[model samples]
Target: MPEKKLNQKRKEFNKEKMVGIWSLVSLEVTDENGQKTYPMGEDATGFIMYHPEGYMSAQIMQSGRPQYASGEVLCGTQEEMAAASNGYLAYAGPYQVDEINKMVTHHMAVSLYPNWLGDTQPRYLDIKGDTLEITSQPVFFNGKEHNTKLIWKRVS
Candidate 1:
Protein backbone atom coordinates (compact mmCIF):
# COMPACT_ATOMS: atom_id res chain seq x y z
CA MET A 1 0.00 0.00 0.00
CA PRO A 2 1.21 3.51 -0.81
CA GLU A 3 1.83 5.99 2.01
CA LYS A 4 -0.43 8.63 0.48
CA LYS A 5 -3.25 6.17 0.15
CA LEU A 6 -2.78 5.13 3.74
CA ASN A 7 -2.93 8.71 4.92
CA GLN A 8 -6.10 9.36 2.95
CA LYS A 9 -7.64 6.26 4.40
CA ARG A 10 -6.73 7.40 7.88
CA LYS A 11 -8.23 10.81 7.31
CA GLU A 12 -11.42 9.30 6.01
CA PHE A 13 -11.61 7.06 9.02
CA ASN A 14 -11.13 9.98 11.37
CA LYS A 15 -13.85 11.98 9.66
CA GLU A 16 -16.24 9.08 9.94
CA LYS A 17 -15.56 8.81 13.63
CA MET A 18 -16.72 12.39 14.14
CA VAL A 19 -19.74 12.53 11.86
CA GLY A 20 -22.70 12.36 14.22
CA ILE A 21 -24.79 14.18 16.79
CA TRP A 22 -23.30 14.01 20.21
CA SER A 23 -25.08 14.85 23.44
CA LEU A 24 -23.14 16.45 26.21
CA VAL A 25 -22.52 14.04 29.04
CA SER A 26 -20.36 16.14 31.27
CA LEU A 27 -18.31 19.30 31.30
CA GLU A 28 -15.62 20.02 33.84
CA VAL A 29 -12.93 22.64 34.16
CA THR A 30 -9.82 22.02 36.17
CA ASP A 31 -7.90 25.07 37.22
CA GLU A 32 -4.17 25.43 37.80
CA ASN A 33 -4.65 24.72 41.49
CA GLY A 34 -6.31 21.42 40.57
CA GLN A 35 -9.76 22.49 41.69
CA LYS A 36 -12.52 21.26 39.45
CA THR A 37 -15.60 23.30 38.75
CA TYR A 38 -18.65 23.09 36.56
CA PRO A 39 -19.06 26.58 35.24
CA MET A 40 -22.28 25.62 33.57
CA GLY A 41 -23.73 24.28 36.78
CA GLU A 42 -24.05 20.64 37.75
CA ASP A 43 -26.56 19.84 35.05
CA ALA A 44 -25.56 21.25 31.68
CA THR A 45 -27.39 20.33 28.50
CA GLY A 46 -25.81 20.66 25.12
CA PHE A 47 -25.34 19.12 21.73
CA ILE A 48 -22.51 19.16 19.26
CA MET A 49 -22.94 18.05 15.69
CA TYR A 50 -20.22 17.14 13.22
CA HIS A 51 -20.99 16.92 9.54
CA PRO A 52 -19.17 14.82 7.03
CA GLU A 53 -18.68 17.94 4.94
CA GLY A 54 -16.46 19.38 7.71
CA TYR A 55 -18.79 21.79 9.43
CA MET A 56 -19.78 21.75 13.06
CA SER A 57 -21.86 23.58 15.61
CA ALA A 58 -22.09 23.40 19.35
CA GLN A 59 -24.43 24.79 21.99
CA ILE A 60 -24.21 24.31 25.71
CA MET A 61 -26.19 25.87 28.47
CA GLN A 62 -26.47 25.58 32.16
CA SER A 63 -29.76 24.21 33.40
CA GLY A 64 -32.27 26.17 35.46
CA ARG A 65 -31.57 29.62 34.07
CA PRO A 66 -34.08 32.24 35.08
CA GLN A 67 -36.61 33.27 32.49
CA TYR A 68 -36.73 36.84 31.27
CA ALA A 69 -39.60 38.82 32.68
CA SER A 70 -40.52 40.37 29.36
CA GLY A 71 -39.94 37.12 27.49
CA GLU A 72 -38.31 39.00 24.68
CA VAL A 73 -34.75 39.03 23.52
CA LEU A 74 -34.58 42.79 23.20
CA CYS A 75 -36.60 43.41 26.30
CA GLY A 76 -34.27 41.64 28.64
CA THR A 77 -32.77 43.84 31.30
CA GLN A 78 -29.04 44.22 31.55
CA GLU A 79 -28.77 41.81 34.42
CA GLU A 80 -30.98 39.27 32.70
CA MET A 81 -28.89 39.35 29.56
CA ALA A 82 -25.73 39.05 31.55
CA ALA A 83 -27.04 36.06 33.43
CA ALA A 84 -28.23 34.39 30.26
CA SER A 85 -25.00 34.97 28.46
CA ASN A 86 -22.96 33.70 31.34
CA GLY A 87 -24.94 30.47 31.43
CA TYR A 88 -24.73 29.70 27.73
CA LEU A 89 -22.02 29.11 25.18
CA ALA A 90 -22.54 28.57 21.50
CA TYR A 91 -20.34 28.56 18.39
CA ALA A 92 -20.32 27.19 14.92
CA GLY A 93 -17.94 26.97 12.00
CA PRO A 94 -15.81 24.79 9.79
CA TYR A 95 -13.60 22.22 11.42
CA GLN A 96 -10.54 20.18 10.62
CA VAL A 97 -9.52 16.91 12.12
CA ASP A 98 -5.89 15.89 12.23
CA GLU A 99 -5.97 12.13 12.54
CA ILE A 100 -2.27 11.73 13.21
CA ASN A 101 -2.28 14.37 15.89
CA LYS A 102 -5.64 13.29 17.35
CA MET A 103 -6.79 16.87 17.43
CA VAL A 104 -9.79 18.77 16.10
CA THR A 105 -9.57 22.47 15.34
CA HIS A 106 -12.71 24.51 15.09
CA HIS A 107 -12.45 27.64 12.97
CA MET A 108 -14.99 29.70 14.79
CA ALA A 109 -16.94 31.82 12.34
CA VAL A 110 -19.54 32.84 14.88
CA SER A 111 -19.82 32.58 18.62
CA LEU A 112 -21.96 33.91 21.41
CA TYR A 113 -18.85 35.28 23.03
CA PRO A 114 -17.44 37.96 20.77
CA ASN A 115 -13.88 37.28 21.83
CA TRP A 116 -14.09 33.74 20.47
CA LEU A 117 -15.29 34.77 17.05
CA GLY A 118 -12.70 34.30 14.34
CA ASP A 119 -10.56 32.24 16.65
CA THR A 120 -9.30 28.77 15.93
CA GLN A 121 -9.74 26.54 18.93
CA PRO A 122 -7.96 23.20 18.93
CA ARG A 123 -9.08 20.38 21.18
CA TYR A 124 -7.44 17.05 21.80
CA LEU A 125 -9.88 14.21 21.13
CA ASP A 126 -10.30 10.71 22.40
CA ILE A 127 -13.06 8.73 20.78
CA LYS A 128 -14.11 5.42 22.27
CA GLY A 129 -17.21 3.66 21.06
CA ASP A 130 -20.17 5.96 21.75
CA THR A 131 -18.13 8.36 23.89
CA LEU A 132 -16.03 11.25 22.66
CA GLU A 133 -13.94 13.20 25.11
CA ILE A 134 -12.49 16.53 24.04
CA THR A 135 -9.99 18.42 26.13
CA SER A 136 -9.26 22.05 25.43
CA GLN A 137 -5.75 23.37 25.66
CA PRO A 138 -5.09 25.53 28.69
CA VAL A 139 -7.41 28.48 28.35
CA PHE A 140 -7.72 31.57 30.48
CA PHE A 141 -11.09 31.61 32.18
CA ASN A 142 -12.05 33.96 34.99
CA GLY A 143 -8.46 35.19 35.28
CA LYS A 144 -6.96 31.72 35.65
CA GLU A 145 -5.82 29.07 33.22
CA HIS A 146 -7.95 25.98 33.08
CA ASN A 147 -8.29 22.86 31.02
CA THR A 148 -11.87 22.07 30.08
CA LYS A 149 -12.98 18.53 29.41
CA LEU A 150 -16.23 17.89 27.65
CA ILE A 151 -17.59 14.39 27.38
CA TRP A 152 -20.11 13.58 24.72
CA LYS A 153 -22.07 10.52 23.77
CA ARG A 154 -23.05 9.71 20.22
CA VAL A 155 -26.78 10.34 19.81
CA SER A 156 -27.11 9.23 16.24
Candidate 2:
Protein backbone atom coordinates (compact mmCIF):
# COMPACT_ATOMS: atom_id res chain seq x y z
CA MET A 1 0.00 0.00 0.00
CA PRO A 2 1.15 3.55 -0.75
CA GLU A 3 2.28 5.71 2.19
CA LYS A 4 -0.65 8.11 1.71
CA LYS A 5 -3.14 5.24 1.56
CA LEU A 6 -1.75 3.75 4.75
CA ASN A 7 -2.10 7.05 6.56
CA GLN A 8 -5.68 7.41 5.40
CA LYS A 9 -6.54 3.94 6.62
CA ARG A 10 -5.08 4.71 10.01
CA LYS A 11 -7.12 7.86 10.32
CA GLU A 12 -10.28 6.01 9.39
CA PHE A 13 -9.63 3.35 11.95
CA ASN A 14 -9.14 5.91 14.70
CA LYS A 15 -12.39 7.63 13.80
CA GLU A 16 -14.36 4.41 13.86
CA LYS A 17 -12.89 3.32 17.16
CA MET A 18 -14.78 6.04 19.15
CA VAL A 19 -18.25 5.81 17.73
CA GLY A 20 -20.89 4.75 20.29
CA ILE A 21 -23.17 5.79 23.16
CA TRP A 22 -21.16 6.02 26.36
CA SER A 23 -23.45 5.95 29.34
CA LEU A 24 -22.43 7.55 32.59
CA VAL A 25 -23.38 4.57 34.70
CA SER A 26 -21.11 6.05 37.35
CA LEU A 27 -19.23 9.31 37.78
CA GLU A 28 -16.71 11.08 39.99
CA VAL A 29 -15.94 14.80 39.65
CA THR A 30 -13.26 16.53 41.63
CA ASP A 31 -14.12 19.81 43.30
CA GLU A 32 -12.27 23.04 42.50
CA ASN A 33 -10.30 22.67 45.71
CA GLY A 34 -8.75 19.50 44.25
CA GLN A 35 -8.32 18.35 47.81
CA LYS A 36 -11.30 16.01 47.56
CA THR A 37 -13.37 14.22 44.95
CA TYR A 38 -17.12 13.83 44.77
CA PRO A 39 -18.65 10.57 43.69
CA MET A 40 -22.10 10.42 42.25
CA GLY A 41 -24.72 8.53 44.24
CA GLU A 42 -26.47 5.45 42.93
CA ASP A 43 -29.22 7.72 41.56
CA ALA A 44 -26.65 9.84 39.76
CA THR A 45 -26.49 8.27 36.33
CA GLY A 46 -26.51 9.73 32.81
CA PHE A 47 -25.77 8.98 29.16
CA ILE A 48 -24.08 10.50 26.16
CA MET A 49 -25.72 9.42 22.92
CA TYR A 50 -23.59 9.98 19.83
CA HIS A 51 -25.39 10.03 16.51
CA PRO A 52 -24.13 9.84 12.93
CA GLU A 53 -26.11 13.03 12.26
CA GLY A 54 -23.23 15.09 13.63
CA TYR A 55 -24.90 15.49 17.00
CA MET A 56 -25.20 13.89 20.44
CA SER A 57 -27.24 13.88 23.65
CA ALA A 58 -25.54 14.36 27.03
CA GLN A 59 -27.69 14.17 30.13
CA ILE A 60 -26.99 13.92 33.86
CA MET A 61 -29.19 13.28 36.86
CA GLN A 62 -30.43 16.17 38.96
CA SER A 63 -29.39 16.48 42.56
CA GLY A 64 -32.02 16.42 45.28
CA ARG A 65 -35.52 17.87 44.83
CA PRO A 66 -36.52 20.24 42.06
CA GLN A 67 -35.49 23.88 42.48
CA TYR A 68 -37.11 26.24 40.02
CA ALA A 69 -35.39 29.53 39.59
CA SER A 70 -37.27 32.80 39.74
CA GLY A 71 -37.44 35.16 36.76
CA GLU A 72 -36.53 33.99 33.28
CA VAL A 73 -33.13 32.53 34.09
CA LEU A 74 -33.15 28.80 34.66
CA CYS A 75 -30.40 29.18 37.23
CA GLY A 76 -31.78 30.72 40.35
CA THR A 77 -30.01 33.66 41.84
CA GLN A 78 -29.22 33.62 45.57
CA GLU A 79 -32.37 35.57 46.17
CA GLU A 80 -34.44 33.25 44.01
CA MET A 81 -33.23 30.15 45.79
CA ALA A 82 -34.71 31.55 48.98
CA ALA A 83 -38.06 31.94 47.25
CA ALA A 84 -38.54 28.61 45.50
CA SER A 85 -36.79 25.41 44.58
CA ASN A 86 -37.42 24.22 41.03
CA GLY A 87 -34.40 22.96 39.20
CA TYR A 88 -34.03 19.84 37.06
CA LEU A 89 -33.61 16.11 37.10
CA ALA A 90 -31.88 15.31 33.83
CA TYR A 91 -30.92 17.04 30.60
CA ALA A 92 -29.54 16.13 27.16
CA GLY A 93 -28.17 17.66 23.98
CA PRO A 94 -26.71 17.16 20.52
CA TYR A 95 -22.98 16.78 19.98
CA GLN A 96 -20.16 15.90 17.57
CA VAL A 97 -17.09 13.80 18.13
CA ASP A 98 -13.63 14.43 16.74
CA GLU A 99 -12.03 11.03 16.86
CA ILE A 100 -8.64 12.24 15.75
CA ASN A 101 -8.38 14.54 18.77
CA LYS A 102 -10.28 12.29 21.13
CA MET A 103 -12.53 15.28 21.80
CA VAL A 104 -16.30 15.22 21.94
CA THR A 105 -17.93 18.61 21.26
CA HIS A 106 -21.45 19.27 22.31
CA HIS A 107 -23.49 21.38 19.85
CA MET A 108 -26.68 22.06 21.78
CA ALA A 109 -28.04 21.20 25.17
CA VAL A 110 -31.54 20.07 25.98
CA SER A 111 -31.15 20.27 29.76
CA LEU A 112 -28.98 21.34 32.68
CA TYR A 113 -27.46 24.61 31.48
CA PRO A 114 -30.01 26.36 29.30
CA ASN A 115 -27.70 29.31 28.58
CA TRP A 116 -25.52 26.81 26.75
CA LEU A 117 -28.26 26.73 24.15
CA GLY A 118 -26.03 26.80 21.06
CA ASP A 119 -22.68 26.83 22.80
CA THR A 120 -20.12 24.16 21.98
CA GLN A 121 -17.84 22.45 24.50
CA PRO A 122 -15.06 20.05 23.61
CA ARG A 123 -14.32 17.38 26.20
CA TYR A 124 -11.21 15.21 26.14
CA LEU A 125 -12.15 11.59 26.74
CA ASP A 126 -10.09 8.47 27.34
CA ILE A 127 -12.06 5.26 27.00
CA LYS A 128 -10.98 1.97 28.48
CA GLY A 129 -13.50 -0.76 27.96
CA ASP A 130 -16.52 0.30 30.04
CA THR A 131 -14.59 3.00 31.86
CA LEU A 132 -14.19 6.56 30.60
CA GLU A 133 -11.97 9.31 31.90
CA ILE A 134 -13.15 12.82 31.04
CA THR A 135 -10.91 15.78 31.68
CA SER A 136 -12.09 19.37 31.33
CA GLN A 137 -8.99 21.52 31.33
CA PRO A 138 -10.66 24.92 31.65
CA VAL A 139 -14.40 25.01 31.58
CA PHE A 140 -15.82 28.49 32.05
CA PHE A 141 -18.39 28.57 34.82
CA ASN A 142 -19.70 31.74 36.49
CA GLY A 143 -17.20 33.71 34.44
CA LYS A 144 -14.30 31.65 35.76
CA GLU A 145 -12.23 28.96 34.12
CA HIS A 146 -12.59 25.80 36.17
CA ASN A 147 -10.32 22.80 35.94
CA THR A 148 -12.49 19.73 36.18
CA LYS A 149 -11.96 15.98 35.91
CA LEU A 150 -14.62 13.33 35.62
CA ILE A 151 -14.42 9.53 35.57
CA TRP A 152 -17.32 7.35 34.53
CA LYS A 153 -17.99 3.62 34.35
CA ARG A 154 -20.47 2.01 31.98
CA VAL A 155 -23.19 0.09 33.75
CA SER A 156 -25.24 -0.77 30.70
Question: Pick by lDDT: which candidate is best?
Answer: 1
TM-score: model 2 vs. ground truth: 0.59
Task: Tell me each candidate's TM-score.
Answer: 0.88, 0.59
Instruction: List candidate 2 segments past 4 Å from native.
Output: 1-15, 31-33, 37-43, 62-93, 140-145, 154-156
Instruction: List, residue by residue over 54-99, the lDDT tens digit for candidate 2.
Output: 6666666534634554445567776566433232223456666665
lDDT of 1 by residue, 37-82 (tens): 9989779999999999999999999999999999886888999999
In candidate 1, which residue pairs clash? none
Tell me how far the alpha carbon of residue 41 in candidate 2 is from the true structure, in angstroms, after superposition: 5.0
Residue-pair clashes per prediction, in order, are 0, 9
Error of 2 at 59 (Å): 1.7
What lDDT does model 2 reach?
Answer: 0.58
